[model samples]
Target: DANGTTWIYKPREKTAVMSRIPLLPYPMILLEKYERDAELRATGKLLPVPSNQKMNAYLKEIADICNIPKNLTTHVARHTFACLAVEYGMPIDVLAKILGHSNTNMTRHYTKFSEQLIGREMRKMNEQMFSDDVFLLNQ
Candidate 1:
């Protein structure tokens, strides 16, 4: 029997590792409801895990509904996750581990930073190192 947490193992990596992902309270409750309605066991794997082809087809439909211009695929979702995580201030090392990347260099390839994000980070650095006193004093 397992608890509310699960580990995702990447055996194909050069160095195999497991990532612990917790099921937050709201999702846990929904999962419990699904289990009860589906008559699933604690040990049973979740059902209706769609195949890659089917998942890609569904993603295409979703992209259309969202008015996205690019092709959507599983790899695209991975890149999206990487981009969002970095854009939202997740550390590169932590993102690397979450992405099952063996090195930060590999993880860097997956993340694309926007010019605005770069400028924002630079501005934050400047604010931290300098103060308004450097600008002007009370007249």
Candidate 2:
């Protein structure tokens, strides 16, 4: 049963404890629905949280339903969150906070910038450096 509030799980080894992650509106709504379902099941009923294996199986089913070709796992969701945040220009420190990493280095493992993105940034920099006005100014 959810404590009706979100809690962060922090590892003792790390100073960074998991802090309350504010869910987006849709997810918050979904959480409310799940909580209500859990409440209903508590009434003379037993509905336990699924095991990791069961949860992964369900996640794979969801990916299949969505026609996603890649394998779906819990870790993939975390990685995706980090990668997307990086792509969207979120600072590494902020990403670390979201991922509950005590050190920024730990968060780096989750961030993977595509080669195409790197190339794009390089091209932008090159274009700015080699612009006609800049080149003329150098002469």
- TM-score versus the correct structure, for each prediction: 0.74, 0.61
- lDDT of each candidate versus the true structure: 0.79, 0.75
Q: Which pairs, if any, clash in model 2?
A: none
lDDT (Cα, tens digit) per residue for candidate 2, span 3-52: 56544344533454546465556765665566657565676322345676
Top lDDT prediction, candidate number: 1
